[model samples]
Target: MSSAAKRKLYLLKLSPEGNASLLGILQHPDGTVLKQLQPPPRGPREQEFYNKVYDSDCCDRILLELREYLPKYFGVWSPPTAPNDTYLKLEDVTRKFNKPCIMDVKIGQKSYDPYASAEKIQQQVSKYPLMEEIGFLVLGMRVYHVSSDSYETQNQHYGRSLTKETVKDGISKFFHSGYCLRKDVVAASIQKVEKILEWFEGQTQLNFYASSLLFVYEGSCQATTMRLSDVTLAEKRRVPKGLLSGGDVLEYNNNIHVINSTENGKIEASVGKGLSKFYALHKKSCSKRHHSQLSLKVENSEQDNVWKSSTCITQEHLNGNVLPQLEKVFYHMPAEPKESAKVEVRMIDFAHVFPSNTKDEGYIYGLKNLITVLQNILDN
Candidate 1:
């Protein structure tokens, strides 16, 4: 059956938070959503990028490899009544979550594409002067507060108010369940971003400008908890003196774990209800052992703050790896427990992609900063 005949006949109320389109995005019952094709250059540019990446016959290695990091794309859909209205059908990444917390972050130091005019560059720089240093910007986010049984939406204006110091805190708020914080999700998300970073490090075919990363995770506080009478940190590394008790270091098993930031007093009370743990390992020097592996150790890239392979390791990178394996094995990853707090991060908005000869240093710089911010959040 045609996708239009499936379930996207009506307007969608739950489109993403920071949509800049004249019409909202649409969702079909077939586990896909529709984004209306904008006019002229922008629409054609996005479609071109998607088609090249999605094309099966096109043997371009980078585009083919990038397919996994993006939403699965179907062909364009045009309503019979409104023939001019075209929409791109894409995988609905949040469909599986009961209450998904979503955030959109735009990456890179430059928002304008290579084809952009001087005036456009001036406008973008004036809007956010720190983009060159930060390399990323938070556009919008929606978080589900389990305590209130409601979701609060924050728009781009709130994102614009953030400073470099407060950006981590703002990002931290997305994981706050009101009752506890979800660092497990943070760790998993970092791994995924690292994978994307690894891809950017080796590729020279295209440069992604103004591209954004979309993050979605289950926000319902009814976190899968089967009263674990006992829990322990992996490898039994002793945490600092007072960090675990009340300093927000949670050291439970790796499945969907959260922490009480203010007090551990309720821990005894909450244990019966089931409480999981979260631990972020930070090593000040390279002499540390028994550390987790992070893929930020690309040999070819010029990234600093390197974090893997006889160097800066944390707890575990989960399914992350530093070496580039065979294509088939690289994409096939071990699965986490179904009950574990799940997170989905995919690259979106490819309208500004440009063919280049070398690695995207701007994007890589932004990603490194992003991972550092998340690391700080995890450690603190």
Candidate 2:
């Protein structure tokens, strides 16, 4: 993560004060965070997850301790008159790590709909060949939007091609300020994810249909860890296999774009001179565009040009200083250092997760593929 002062703090929780769903950070005058969630209008997904899945009789009997693998669930919140307006509040896992860089990956295929109409399923299936040709698809990236800004601004910035953006928008903000996952942390995260999958095997009465894993990474050195979140998409199947009509198969979508990997590569390749060089390049490009747009008398959108065009470290220090210092720090480091990366991989986003009366092959196959991808990343 960049220096605390320069980092654009990302807040994903919705405040109890606001009726509308919001995705931005909220802080006290002294800088203390007040993270909370506001439920969606139509979905009882998260509520169902906590009531039926996490707190179920089946989970109590077979599942291991939840805290070891998951974040602490605080309980549900509801408004006075509106039964529909209910929110699920859980521990803000990002706060557990210093300078967290969070990433949310929606598991399964984009076109996948287990309950979709037959025609829709066929259409989605037909597109699989073309989708396979594309390496991995990133469904979404957690981004920082100003409090007064609408979702469109953030979405527009994120939707833009990564390499094409030059402004201090969402992508730039994340790369410039977010935590970068080091190799050790990545390995730890993979191992923890596998362990959780193994735990899933024990709950034969429950079939976990997960759609996403929100990975939260923290730390600057080899001493780091990743926290998983957002289990609203997971659920227990109606019945276990064998006695069931068909088994469940975990669908694997090869299109994955992890923020750590993407940003790390950019930093190593283009910003080796450190963040200052990248900032310099970005500022130069932005200034030129801004000046040209100024003469047109067009509306100067705040979202486009509002970010501070600066970095924590100077170019001289970044180029002539940092790496050698890090090398010296790790000179006598063990393969897995004593206080090495500590990753907490908890499966999240259980909204789409439900009981499947099918074989478990789909779910297992998808999970193994994900593990393989993580392993390959470490190997490379």
Candidate 3:
């Protein structure tokens, strides 16, 4: 069936709540989600990046090494109904990573564009002196703006604004308190980031950088994965709108696997019941004939061997199995018994990447800030 026609059928069968909660509108037979975005300047750029950078044989050595930190790229789709819109079919990270609670954030200054105008250039130079020294700052870190999956909406609940501090705070909270990542994983992730920066600096033909980052937390088996709640760092007022085609629209998808909402006054006691109810509802709703068949294939992304890779730093070389210093106070006491636990932080949103003329100052600035933020989260 045509994509547009499918959407009309979805609207008729799904309830108001179900429609709002739906995150996947065009699930490929292979299980990848098809995201369609309007003709923004960044849309075509993003489509090009996926086609030529990740999937193409541009920089296989470096990109393959850093693949763990990126979303898997399938191909592109151009629906006849929306000629102006660009559709990118990508491996749904949530499904690929086993429905982990995800968080999105922009690392650098959003308003200050170094190359836009003279005033902006001066402002950036004065604002990011340290970034100039680092030699690797991205142009403008825009998570919500470029991604079709992330809708354009004002954040209200978390903080009615989006800024550097808000983004950092959101990231810090997720790493320090929200989920308990192993000390080795944390150290390895930092090393990977540093290596990626070095690779970018060495590149001659193509300069790669990310405006936004995504953190996916694969909670323990016992932990409930709330598939409809990955909130933006700014705590978006409403979930970011997903792919929209005619009457059919895919809602945002997020999994709140770590912390369950408070209920009947006792938060801890309510978790079990809430999980039961969620799963029960999911099974019942999915059993309906109208629903699209959910697809979950065994993912072989670079992350599968991230910990086992010999090139990166090993766990034994770092601190022992005990949690890092920050974990003692911030992390939950007696951390949840996670079976096959995995946590990853990867840079995403490459639509705005442009060749740097004024040295790698902007790119360096963003990278240094991100590394520092991540390190601080790990150490203290």
Candidate 4:
């Protein structure tokens, strides 16, 4: 099997307080840098110094806003630091809130049993007042080995041996099945566990669906493994077909149908392209009345300009060019209508590269414009 066929998985769990800490880091001026800093000393003096430096009024405001914005399913906990690196008990936070707050944990292994581990975790966390229950979310990635037999079978099925189309189809099917399984089973399980955690957090009075929107990553190694297992089971259940006399005629007929369909698709694509070009060429020659009618038709046929603009900005990054730069400026402008109140700006490619100072500046400007536009939209 190729190295690409191997799989790996990782799982993460976060309590409400842990999440708040993370959000605090994200919102801070030097958030990215601060994450690399070690926890403060465990002594009272150290704690006081750390608080003086990092815990400003702005931090309190952000924390309050976060409490309101964040989902309530997770629990929160806190403990003061000591100089010796020993921390205080979470009981303090629990006492202040007049409720239980569970600790957040993350654990994973390549061949780990998630269910058994989750059960163990639930047992361990039960010692806390508000943490009698716990939940686990799992994420994984896996690579499947396309055996020589399956490759030959796929090639025969398409009447061409392992072509680009066959490989594309196989990979697409693999990813689709993996994604679906994660959403249906793993995500549902996470929600179930979170509900158990919430119940322990003194949210017993509130009613919630078992499958509420608990966060779950769609792509992971574990999801891939589960998907592969399912696929293997399905393959095992398949009955092999027996060759019969006079099969040549049937095979020929199927080949002809396939060839015809391929030809038809090519013809359709060519025709569509030709028509698009023709329309574009003649569109400018129309009379004012015709142009007005065309404009109305176009307007009705396509999404509104605002939506188009928003989508376009999201698809591309700002490069200090006129269009994106203008968008960045305009995003800071306040607008009317609550829906348009928030500006959506896209500048940095978060996935591909680390954001530079210039990109950060662009993002800030874009956010400013977005807020301004939203304000205008709301006022009008």
Candidate 5:
């Protein structure tokens, strides 16, 4: 038997709330199961199942009893939490290292049979929460194998329609965060199966927000695929349109071209002479045209510090000139310079104003000691 035939197969069963049950099937080189070990389950279960199985008072107790079975594949169990709680913590770990995480779900019919109505199975799996969380991010395929006993007797009787429905159901469930056996040939080796499962796990670790942001920047506008960055740059350079000498005209071919204020004595005519002409040309070129103008005047005042103020801009308005202007205004704000540094130091009150006070002095001295120790380590 070839080395590839000796790989392990995996079955990942995920509860509705995102807890996992992993079943690893070690396969012999001849495509036979060598051993099958159910992964220790994690997270809260139905009260009845918990009471009957572990006789534990709480979920944590059950987890403790099952601790020996964990850390066998994944290093530690990090249960799912709300986004804000998980983000910074996960960021801390991922900033220094990369790890693979796979996600899977189980699918079984009321008859305890692998083959079932595809549409029905899909509808059930679609309701799972984990499917909703990562649905847009992945595509899944189904693999099917029958129990040894059933495979021999039912092989000839199993119609192609059943196989097709099984495969379809499996894919639908897999897409909806559920897994089921399909008619597609299962990986001959258990190790190959485990590898596929691990691939999905790694995808789950990917930050969804970050990925979406990247997609927005990379995706095209309109039916035609054009680069977002290019569109933004073009918009930034667009010249405003206006009437020139009693006729509408376009002053610039693209936004990058600078309008000469005195090229044709055009500025003296109206509020937006050359710019209005540019807008007219733009309207003619694009399928849809809407024009609005905004003007702002700021008067210098010590009380009204525009430089330090924050402004709200919707994601749609974040491109073009607005983004660059905001960046320029905030360019000098104080920031931490080091990437590896943790714990930003800030005074609780006016420490500088009352430096000699006991509380202020104590804080200052404590900070000084902490910094000194950190500095010493770096120096050594």
Candidate 6:
């Protein structure tokens, strides 16, 4: 049996303090997550993005550079026992963190796609009117609090209530563990995102709407200071997949339960850089909750971006450093390097993307504003 097949599955469980957006996401001990394709245009659209990027023959310069900001893709998968239930077997972006403080912020002034009806547009606008002004909305968040030995979380409701003046504070809270405000981590995140902005500035291939930047950093201070090594990164993660599966996750709930998965835990074996989480939160309790999966808006149109048919990566990288003075700014290393990533800012949710001949200004505007907000936090 393939090692992936021999492995058991577990629900990717998040702490009650933190909310996850997707439903039916399963994780394995080997640092992979499986997201079931949802119905219709959304499923097809997202699958389409991954397919093109991972297309063995694909060499699009924009995509090649953009792939660095995305999670690794391993192609569509369906368990041998459940062929009818196909899934996108992807890398879990949060796998490396000992205590992952995750945030999903929907970017862009317009959340609705070009195809949105007036009613649909109004519904999105009504939820967060400031989306146009702020260019981003905090959809979900979970931050690890070190001193208290717990996690703190803020959901979409909290995101919508922030005023323009306090938006910086709202963002500051994410970088602040109860113990300290991590300016270093904030700085690193900014640097990473700056790279993404550079790509958007040059590309006219895709317009991203109703998408999110999934930010994650190691919340455990001890882990951050340890000088990460292959040996240290190999240390397991937090909780298993629900339905209860295998993983590096050693603890879950207030109570502690450790399961040392004997499965192949090597990071190298996992395909592509891990993907941002793909889940539509469904609370099955008395409250009975259902939400769109991080607002990756779906489109019914059959049009495809003409940019997909472009050239592949040459040895020198992305048509030879489009901005060399910016410091080899265009080179995209192969995804999933041997050294584990300590912090991440992944651009996720492609269902609402449109073909564009000019830059993705809306997404870029939000990114610039976000950088300013984060920078202020770091300064103060």
Winning candidate number (TM-score):
6
Q: Write the per-residue lDDT of candidate 1 for residues 243-358, one digit (tens) a residue.
A: 12223222121111121222422211012111111111101112333434332221221245321111122223322343222111111111342236578889988778888999
Mind giving the per-residue lDDT tens digits that candidate 2 earns over 46-75? 456556545635446444443456555556
**Runs in model 3 lying further than 4 Å from the true structure:** 1-26, 55-69, 79-85, 109-170, 176-185, 204-210, 221-341, 357-359
Model 1: lDDT equals 0.61
CA lDDT, every model vs. true structure:
0.61, 0.36, 0.40, 0.20, 0.21, 0.61
Model 2 local distance difference test score: 0.36
Better of 1 and 6 by TM-score: 6
Taking the tens digit of each residue's C-alpha lDDT, what string does model 3 give over 110-139? 423423568766765564443333332322
Worst 10-residue lDDT window, candidate 6: 305-314
TM-score of 4: 0.16
Off by over 4 Å in 5: 1-45, 56-97, 109-380
Which model is ahead, 5 or 6, in terms of lDDT? 6
TM-scores for every candidate against the unseen true structure: 0.66, 0.50, 0.47, 0.16, 0.15, 0.66
lDDT of 6 by residue, 1-380 (tens): 22223221222234344443334555644557766787878788889988887788888988888888987898877654445666787777866566677888888999999899999999999999999999998876766654434556566777888889999988888886553466667878888888888999999989998888989886765322111233321133221121112333332221111122223431122211111221222231123222211111112222452111111212222223332122211112112322233678898777777678988889999999888888899789
Q: lDDT per residue, candidate 4, 1-380, as tens digits?
A: 22221111111122322220121111111111111122432134323323332334545432233233122211111212212222211111111111111111211111122233676555534422121111211111111211100100011112112232232233222222211211222223233333333322432221111111112222211101012122432232221121111121111000001001133232011122222332232223222111110000001122443311111111112222223112221111112322321111111101111212222222222223322322333233
Rank candidates by lDDT, best first.
6, 1, 3, 2, 5, 4
Model 4: runs farther than 4 Å from truth?
1-62, 68-83, 87-380
Clashing pairs in 1: 250-278, 292-314
lDDT of candidate 1 at residue 223, scale 0 to 100: 19
Predict model 3's lDDT versus the native: 0.40
lDDT at 262 for candidate 3?
A: 39
